[model samples]
Target: METTLHHLHRPLGSTGLNVSPLGLGTVKLGRDQGVKYPNGFRIPDDSQARQLLALARGLGINLIDTAPAYGVSEQRLGPLLQGQRDHWVVVSKVGEEFIDGRSHFDFSPAHTRLSVERSLKRLKTDRIELVLVHSDGRDLEILQHSGVYEALAELKREGKILGYGLSGKTVEGGLLALEHGDCAMVTYNLNEQAERPVLDYAQAHGKGILVKKALASGHVCLKSDEDPVRLSFELLFGHPGVGAAIVGTINPQHLSDNVRTAAAVLSQQQ
Candidate 1:
């Protein structure tokens, strides 16, 4: 399918960051935790991954989201975008640690600071466009923690991070972060409409809303005749507050199909 790139540029809240409506999720590109479903998805080599990244750029996808906990995702993505780094907006998360092949949450101020520095080295970027606190299901306590927020604010001052946000599963967790953070990547799929209230709040506050798992983590099985995948992308793109949507895929053809589907959906909406 011939893809038009215009459908990819979407406003990222009030931050003035123009990003693709469909973003590349790097969770699976890093490690396989045997979590099932999307978990255990193949991890692409640097060459193939870079080719995909370049394809995203060609299709006008400028926002790339990753987390330090995503195994070697940052390590792979950082160097891959070395030449075209400035052309894209890179986002990463903190508050999670990987030790002895295990993932753990540490939202303390010390850990937050350490995480940012480590992510910078891994991403090979002097300053990240956006940094989010990878909430480990502790939204309330983490928001109240002076150290974590203060550390992020400090990073903003030092120019290491342009802004910070939060990523969580629950609406309450996301709302709590928005009380102190600038952006949010939340799960707001068609089947899970409980997050509409949070989405409205974020829109009112001029905060960016990046939707994750827009396909309901593959729960909404697509129909062979109706193209359920395209419909899902349409639903996500039609959401008024959603600034971006992250869809995980390693197949080049699938990625191109996503871009094509997004173009057709957005065109219909417009």
Candidate 2:
């Protein structure tokens, strides 16, 4: 019973990138401080990280999501992903940075350019596939007033990044981002449907929609004989605009189960 999602890869809007339905989020690979998971866990060591990556690839996961705000995630992935860069659709972020257990944000064009460059250096890659603005809950303000999206567009034209968008918190921000960007990462799950309009807009416009917090940030309540992960994926994959779901699980067993559940759910879609 080997699980795989190789054939379940979906298009990421008009960006011309195809990602697995379940993307492996690398926040736990390099940072454990101030996370919102149900329980605390140690960051995986080098060998362990390698095994986790191998498992992910074995399960046919091709999308890897990391961000500078994820502490040393970008830096750690640089060396870990040495020669297999082409195997994964690498996603990195700008605008939000975690420092000394506190989160800070900068949406200036200058900072946005600098952030992408730094991420490139840290990830040891020539170009990143996708670069998203890590919103600090000020979705509309950042998308409207801040020059972050403009800077991302410039980077896209310059070939530093193939596509750009926002990991936004509000529906208005997600809608506006889809208007000008390739993708929009929104919070979608059983607990929150406030951003459903954003997904509707993406579906109508052929824009990409990446779902974040699909399992309620690891706070999903358990019921007798019911699988929360499967339920979450059903809600996500049932939608037309969802390109992928970013699940930040560092545990190997959890990863395997997630891919298996996602594969089963997607199999029903066909």
Candidate 3:
């Protein structure tokens, strides 16, 4: 029998959103350029993408992460998720766009509002459950000078987004995001724990923390003989504020393995 994660869903802090511990990242579903993965991959076709989504759902994953910076991910998901909108907690991003094989960022309030609106149309959804600012390594500048957070907050008040936050790159940025927003997407894995202070703050303040690159962007298990995936999960769930880990795998077997590893680690925590 296959292990399922439905029983392990947890609250996303005070956002009133419950997400599975493992979220299926859809970057590979739209773009394959300039990614940091160890191995190169071909973008999956519609049939393959649909099967992948079904597989993820079967494994009890409800959180789906995407972004405009991920090429046509939002556009593809709009059509692909035709009838299953409510079944998943869709997380998309603003402030960054992948164009001409490069990344562009706009954190102004006007761009933020436009980006969220465009994402809604692209994803063919009434509202995105959570929208994050796709940071461009200028986390502090963006948070301070840019009115992006205020824009997202307005959208939340308008019911266009349930919650808003930042996919930040620094510990300070992550901490600031949780203070003014509902969650923070930080890089936390076996290899990098630099943003751990942000996780601690979230746990103390009742804010949500979503981990990105949980497996070090496919660079796991270099020094130890232990299972790399399991070690990654152990490090993640051991943290008190980590709500979910977004793993970007297009392969079915890898997805199943990830879910199983996460389930095992979480069960041990219980």
Candidate 4:
């Protein structure tokens, strides 16, 4: 079987940004999972990370999602994508504090502005493609009162950010953001379709929907004995509301597998 994965392009909601159906997630790149791999798992060196990023680009994976809270993920991804920044879309989050050996949510306006500046420095980029408000499972009041959204709007206008979105842990948060946010990043999977209403609403309203935990945080993958992780990827891609799925993998073979799944889904759609 020739396993050269091909690209599948799609529109990213109403942003008019063309992206692949699948995107690279950099969460694990910043964390120490301590999980054993058959090929001896280890974090990729800078060169290795760059090589993988190149492979993703070649495979037509355009969006790369990262976060400051994800350990040193932003730092690792920044230099790797130095020159070819224009070829990919970068999405990051704010409204959270990661310092002093602890993590906490702080959506205050000052903290939000500080987060954007820090992310820009870490990304080594003059402008971010997308910046999302990282919600802390609180009521909508935090998002409204924190003034973070206003700051993000200002950044968008100043060209520091191309667009703004919200990442919420709950459907209510997603819904609120959809009604009031520019875009939404939500946890949507085959097992938990709670966000379906919000997804539909976003689609109808021309709001972008970037799906996270599409594989249920690896639960669906662990339960499967297949090549493509078919169920998880297919379920999300088949949904009309999902603009893109951000899946993570440090293994080259796993990356290839994800692209294969994306190609398969595109073929089925056609």
Candidate scoring better on TM-score of 1 and 3: 3
TM-score to native of every candidate shown: 0.92, 0.98, 0.98, 0.91
By the lDDT metric, which is better: model 1 or model 3?
3
Candidate 3: residue 119 lDDT (0-100): 95
Q: Please tell me which predicted candidate would have the highest TM-score against the true structure.
A: 3
In the range 108-129, model 1's lDDT, one tens digit per residue, is: 8788888899889988889998
How do these models rank on lDDT, best leading? 3, 2, 1, 4
Candidate 3: stretches off by over 4 Å: 221-223
- Highest-scoring model, lDDT: 3
Model 1 / residue 27 / CA error / Å: 1.7
The alpha-carbon root-mean-square deviation between model 4 and the true structure, to one decimal in Å, is: 2.8
- Put down candidate 3 lDDT per residue, 124-223, tens digits, no spaces: 9999999999998889889988999989999999999999999999998998899999999999988789999999999999998899999998888466
- Candidate 1 lDDT at 138 equals 73
Could you give candidate 4's per-residue lDDT for residues 161-180 as a string of tens digits? 88888888777777778776
Q: Stretches of candidate 1 above 4 Å error? A: 38-40, 222-225
lDDT for 65 (candidate 4): 93
> What C-alpha RMSD separates each model from the true structure?
2.0, 1.0, 0.9, 2.8
User: CA lDDT of each candidate?
Assistant: 0.80, 0.92, 0.93, 0.79
- Pitting candidate 2 against candidate 4, the one with the higher lDDT is 2
lDDT of 4 at 243: 85
Clash pairs (backbone) in predicted model 2: none
